[model samples]
Target: MSKKFFEERGDQSAVKAEIIQKYFATWANIILPTAQRYGGGKIAYIDLYAGPGRYKDGAASTPLLVLQKAIENPSLSGALVALFNDMDVNNTQTLQSEIDALLGIEKLKYKPEVNCNAVDHDAEEYFATTKLIPSFTFLDPFGYKGLSLRLVNGVIKDWGCDCVFFFNYNRISLGISNPMVQSHMAALFGDDRAAELRKNVEGVKPALREQMILEELTQALTEMGGKFVLPFRFRNDKGRLTHHLVFVSKSFKGYATMKGIMASASSKADQGVASFAYSPADSSMPLLFELTRPLDDLEGLLKKEYAGRTVSMLDIYESHSVGRPYLSKNYKDVLKKLEDAGDVSVVDPDGKPRRSNSFADRLMVSFPKVKK
Candidate 1:
């Protein structure tokens, strides 16, 4: 971890913090209400590469923001286990000092634990035997020394657990072809898949190479029971793709929650749809014409899936929205458009018309039957 990164907080850094903060807040709220079903009335927030709590410019980082959120909520204060770890001893020491200075730290049942330890030390050794306490783990390792798929699977193996990691694509992409970093690549994508990934990306264009690597990694995670893996790309000032903030979880709700958060922080939106990326030069680019359309295609999907049947917007969204960029609002907007074209009717549960109003989650959308 470089101390210079904390010297001045950049835009991407700030966006990362905001995404974590917003997701953790929503995650805590959803978990606390139904905590008993998940585990033994406990939850955790783990930060493996926690840096100094505050930047030199006086902006707070994820470690501090998490503690502040814990302080604000009484339920979280009582049940949350805050775990901060760093490979660098200096970073952990500064984080401890910052935690101590946080107001009302003693009100929590479990005090925040700060440790200076190797993140991947015996990671997979005890992963299967030892069950974690339903944690949300954030791995922001410097470079790619300690990152491994096994470590990520360990963190998200337990019930109600999720993970968001910083993936340095630029470094990994460059290193994929190097024999010196073969062992490291194997640790990340597993030995067999890693070899395949390297072979597949060879002699390909830069864009296609990137896609191949991401697809290989996604397939690896999918085999480990991680169904929903979302990546938010970050591009440098020169329009070069840098890295991604990838969120992985087995739960659909967690996927949807993080998707909403990331969508808002995106640098550009095509019409009302978010690109789910941040680019330095994106805002300066002018929108000339429509290259793509909205969820009219979604209307076709809905009609094909539920012809002559009626379903609630919530059900429609939950059942079909996974693995797609379409948001809940996109469903509503598309449904409204369908109603106007007489393809579907939006109504309340009691069969009352809601066509003149906003289409809510609970509102029913009835699709008309098509002739054979």
Candidate 2:
């Protein structure tokens, strides 16, 4: 196998890195504390393909950022295990040096009792042998080959483990036709069924074909027992699709936490599919502009499903929250609007019309009856 190359390159930070860092930081901030609060004393973070701790420009990489988050949060000062794995020896050494520097500092506040392990091993082999734990694994590979579907299934088969991976859409699409990598592609999708499906879409439009492949991969994850799968698309400076940050988790809470974080990072207010773009013009700044999708679209969807049906608030939120672009907060807002406009009736447990708009307290929602 080819040695990891990104760290060997002089320039470390790129537009794509900027976009990814924002989402990674957001996710860590939410998940770290939440995991500590509920995980009964132990929490873990595993970064497969962790790079050198900092970019040439001094921007902290994912490993350092995660460590910093743990250090900042006093509540998570319990047993926290952080495993940083990379196949490249230089990358692992660099990360360890950075950690050593942090340890040498005397005055850092809220230092979590971190059991840090830096390993120089292939991510696939590590996952195959390591005993699974309640952890958050970040699988950001340069390409699609190292992260197999079987490994991902094994990681998430138990509870309290969530995965965020870089799905290289451009690379995968370009390589799909190459015969040498066909075995890897088959392993990625967990079977030959997806390969057959891809073969059938030979002449489809480029955009549509990419979407189909994304759907197939996502389906494969869900079939491996993932309760929620979310994909956040990233575009490069020239408006070309780069990679998708795909998240998989068995918990609805994990799904909601990630969805909320992604929504907050988004610049759009429509609360439907969120996308982030990196532009050459704003190289130094965070690019989190929301693409405009009609709010009416969500309203229409809600109406179609909930109209004339009595659905509980939790059920409604759970059903529409994860895997979709919109947030549960947005869904609640739309339901409140429908209630106010006399289109849907929001009720309490006693079946009386709810006086407040809070859906958490409300028991059920009944759409307005159609006039004869």
Candidate 3:
């Protein structure tokens, strides 16, 4: 058995589990409402490198938790589709059995299928054929080689899905830093791009090399016609960093929700009441969120978006099709000011449309209270 496989099955530290749970929760909150409202569209939940349903320490594995959550959450009312893949036949069989046993416990309105195969190959084919339009794929590879950018982007375009990817930066950087193992990076990224990456790495440290790899990955995603939230890192027990990056949509609203989710998670960790921190930047300050500035920038983006649109804030939310908690009071002020400035219009409580002559951004915009 591979050493890394054993480590994953063993008790993943609290931090690791917390990050996984938070990632799951974030998607559940963000994507489920749409699936529920869309009148039963297929919503896929894929595990690219799925392990057995239980950890060696007896905790529920991420794949199982996702399945359970989707089945239980009212928001996940649409088709609860899932695909679990593993390279090892034995592990795959064990996973399949576990899934089947869990399914047998209760009659599920939706049934999920599990397969044993190489995920990178299977993911593309599955995305192509599956009925799931807006999907959620979890690519928790033990290393970077499990899937390639081409495959991932293809799936994203084909399915229009969101993903939470666990990138193994430590292993990838180490693999490339040693001139001896550099050839493997070619297989990981691709032959042409690997050569390009090699040319750029003259004097990069192992850790910074990992950071560069993430930047490159983000750039590739951007070039493929997607905007991404900045990748964040989480550390293991020994203080080694793992690149458990979560990527959401290009929508400023999506970015805003993810920022709020990440911020709340870090706050929970800082209070010593939760498991996921913001990053592994500094051990002394590990709980601090490294992406706060970018989140604030995202708020600024929302401000600009609200400023330019002639629609009311409630109408804006309707257009984006989300109602998360990040839409703050200040955002309301932006809309109110837009209304007061004659830029936008609102419907008041008495079913009368109000158009303000003023142009300030302090007005709170909302849908009129529905009549009883």
> For model 2, how does the per-residue alpha-carbon lDDT over 1-372 read when each residue is reduced to its tens digit?
223334332321343344344544555555566556775556677776777777656667767766765566554434456777776677677777787687422333323222324322344566657766577777777787667787776677665777888888887877677677777677778557557756856888977887788888888889878778987666655445667777788888778777766655543344454543223423443343433554567778878767678988778888865556766666777878887798887667775654565666356888755555
Ranking by TM-score: 1, 2, 3
Using lDDT as the measure, name the better of candidate 2 and candidate 3. Answer: 2
RMSD of each: 2.6, 5.1, 8.3
Q: Any runs in candidate 2 off by more than 4 Å, and if so which? A: 1-40, 103-130, 271-273, 276-293, 350-363, 369-372
lDDT of 1 at 281: 64
Per-candidate TM vs. native? 0.90, 0.80, 0.66
Best first by lDDT, ranked: 1, 2, 3
- Note the Cα lDDT for every prediction shown: 0.84, 0.65, 0.56
In every candidate, how many clashes are there?
0, 2, 8
Model 1 C-alpha lDDT per residue in residues 24-96, reported as the tens digit of each score: 9898888776775656678899998898898999888999998899888888888899988887788889999
lDDT of 2 at 261: 67
Stretches > 4 Å off in candidate 1: 36-39, 287-290, 300-312, 345-349, 352-355, 362-372
Candidate 3 residue 269 C-alpha distance from true site, Å: 9.6
